[model samples]
Every structure is written in structure tokens, then in C-alpha cells.
Target: MTEEDIATASGLPVYTWRRRHGADFRARVPVINPRERLRLYDAAQATAYIKGAPIPASPADDAAHPDDLLSDKEAGVVLGIDATTVRAYATTGYLPPGTERHGRTWWTRRSITVRRDSPDQRHHSPGRQPGDLRDRAPRHRRDPRVTEVSALLLLGQVTTDEIAEHYQVGRRTAQRLLAAALTVSED
Candidate 1:
């Protein structure tokens, strides 16, 4: 088996597996060629390593509600809210910033748990009128939501198509939102 083969079996990148477990793997697989670009593994030793080694944490674990990181949907589950709301909170910076990896968003479990225990700030009186003092703020107020979302896009957490679909806006609107957000952040 090659390093790629071991990586597939271990469910980790070749570099990462090598960096963390290379010495052990090499000691076990005495026949392996260390300098080879495509490192080959001895069958028995590689199989033993693959079977005995603990699998590394994966992005997929986010959706499964792991202890360290969470996807928007997983965060929703922890908070007992809808996934869309989680996404909105994350995109608007109401929730802690999320990490972008492979075009997916992942929030810290600690952040989500903290938010779940915090008070809801969006509550309003039932009889509030359109002319209420709260509503009197200028319409042109800098909406940080778009900017935050754009930052997420720039970070590669969310895609333009996702923004358009979730916001029910056009592709152009999504692009403009990202561009505007990036411009604001740069300043």
C-alpha cells in the first residue's frame, strides 16, 4: 500500500498522517521507502496500523455534533432552533465567527453553547408601530450583516449560490453583497 492508500484507510491527509504518525508507521513497516515520493507500505504493518489507529476528526463530524466544532445545522440542534436561524446568526455576527473549510462553515462548539445560554435580543413588543422610535433609525445605517456574509464568502465558508438561495435574492445581489462587505472590511 502507498501513503495515499494508508491515508484513505486512516481517513486523513497523507502529510498530516505522516507528520503525526510517520515515525510509528515507519518503525512498524520496516520495508517502507522513506524518501519515495509515493511511499509504499508493507501490507501487514499498514493493515495493522489502519485497523488499530484511531480515526482523525473530520469535517463531517461537524454535522454529527462533535464536541469541538459544529456545522450550522448542528449548532441549530444544540440551540434547539432552525438551521436557517443559526446561519443568520453566524452570517450577521450575532454568533461567533465560523471557520471556512472546503466551502462549508463550521462554528466552535463553545461559541454555540454560549449563544444557546445567552438572552435573545430580537424580541419586540407586539403593538410596536412602524413609526416606533426603534424604527426611526436611518434606513441607510451600515448593515454589518452583508459585510459579515461577504467575509464568510471571502473566507470560502459559503458560496454565492448559497447566499442567493438562502437570502432569496438574485445571483447579482449575492455578489454585490459580498463585494460591498469586503470593501467595508478592508477599510
Candidate 2:
């Protein structure tokens, strides 16, 4: 259906549909095919776009704009935030950093929009996946030495002086370590 047909079916006046929020919605609609002077759109999909409804995937969408890419500023608009904020978030691991192409960063619409899916319900933290223990990192942090020292300090079986002697540290340093361990155990 044509834009006018959509306006009429949606109970919006043609002029209103051609302006205001409806016009903004049109900007998001993939341009109608044939690259012609006049274009056509799938009526239901166009209406869905205007109504803020989820659009089902379609072949036409895949065919259009094969090289579609948004610059940092355009991505910011899609994300409803300022450009500088988008740039910072993308660079600092907060948002997906778009590909650096032709000496500039460009983002696909999917990269920015996919982040909106059930974000707060996520289970694990981002970055490296769970797996093997590299030599650089311990298999686990359960060092018996630390556990024994912490236990001795907690049970009053050891004092700052004794801890200093065993660990070969100054009395002041042992006292500080004991105090820190106490505070952590409280938490």
C-alpha cells in the first residue's frame, strides 16, 4: 500500500502522516525498491513501524541497503543518546564498538539495537568465557598460607608481634594486615 493508503487506514490525515511523528517513522522504513521516482511499501510492515511494533524478518529487508552502515553520530541518534556519549560508550566497553572502516568507525543498526533485548536479565558478566586455568592465574585463590594466617588472627592464637616474626614483617605492617583482614571478614 502507498503512504496515503497507510495514513487513511491508520485513521491519520494524509498531511499528518506526511509530517510529524509519522514522518519520522517513515525515515526508519527501508526505502521502497526499484530505486524509482515512486516507491511502494508493505502496508502491514509500514504500519507496524509507525505503531512501534516488532517487525518480523523479511527478505525485502535483507535485500535493501546491503552496505548499510551508520557513523558514530547516526548510531547515537538510533540509540537515543548524544553522539559523544555514544562514542565514549562504544570505545570504553560499554557499547559494541563498530567496525573501523575506511579510516572511520561505522555501525550496523543490528549491533546497536540488539543490546535492547532483556538486558537486565543477563546472568554472567561480559568478556572472556569460562575455561582453563592459565599458568599466570591460580587454579583457585585458596592459598593455605593466607587461610591459616587469617584464621590465627581471628582466633587470637596469634598477635601482631608473632605475625611479624613468622612473616618477617615490621610490627606496624602486620597490625595493618590483621586490621584489613578483620574488616574483610566482617563483610
Candidate 3:
């Protein structure tokens, strides 16, 4: 049925029908092509029906854009570093301060952009390689947590709650620590 017929039968105004189905109706109506119908309908919708409509921007245009907002993972991807390294750098003051709340970290795209543009930012050295022993070495030789968890795991007798209570960490963290220790011992 025609939009006019719909509006008439439904007791709504013809302009309402035109606003809603003017394009499609124009397409099926005699003498009107799809493009002309679409244009007319878009005009009607823009001028009479819609409360607020956005103007279309140019597809080919390039503008001075702001840096994208980034999460830790996204910032790490942009900086070509691992998430752990990014966190370490942020924690150690190598990078500028980022927003921190409830144990989550967030960085602005501008932060990374500015850091990349800065002249004083140090690039990794080419000649000196980090040691393989760094990965395989014992915990006391590396992380301070090593001494604490190693003693508990080596005893092989502590409950998860006991470990959590002793370390003042959450039960989940305690479980993860235990699992990691077991993996290291097996390796």
C-alpha cells in the first residue's frame, strides 16, 4: 500500500507518512527514480521529521587529530613493549604518571605520543643484551617475594588460606603464587 494510503487509513497526517516513507514510496511511485527518491526523502527527514541530524563529514579529508586514548595493553602496543614492561616503566618513573584507581592503570594517547616525540627518551642499547640467567635464577636473587613464597612452598605443607594469611595477599593471589612455584620447581 502507498504511504498516503497508510496514513489515511491510520488517521495520521499525510506529512507524517511522507516523513516516514517518502523515499521508499517515491521509489515505487511512478516517474521517480531511486536516487531522486532517496534525496527527497533525506531532505524531508532532515527538515521536518528528525529532531536533530548530524552533517556528514568529508571522507577524503585529513585533519590534525588528537592522540587516541589508550589502555595499558593499547599503550604497550603503540610503544612496542610488553604490558609488564610498560607497567614496570610507569611504576619506576621512566614514563610520566598515568591515572591509577582501584588497581587499574590508564594512559592517554597523548602521553605515549609526547613520550615518542621527546628527545630525551632513551632507546634500548644495541650492544649489551639482558642475561638469560635473569630468567632462571632463584627468587631471592630476583624478586623479594621469592624468599617468602619459596619457604612456604618448600615446606609443602601449607593450606591456601594459610599462605594467603601469611603473605597478606588474597587467596587467589596465594593460589597463583603456589601454582607458579610448582611450575618453577618442575622446570
Could you give candidate 3's per-residue lDDT for residues 42-66 as a string of tens digits?
2222332333344333222134234
Best by TM-score: 1
lDDT of each: 0.70, 0.66, 0.58
* Clashes in predicted model 3: 0
- Which one is best on lDDT? 1
Ranking 1 against 3 by lDDT, winner: 1
Q: Write the per-residue lDDT of candidate 2 for residues 46-111, one digit (tens) a residue.
A: 778767797545446446352456667666776787889878877766677888754567777777
Error of 1 at 89 (Å): 0.7
In the predicted model 3, the residue pairs found to clash are none
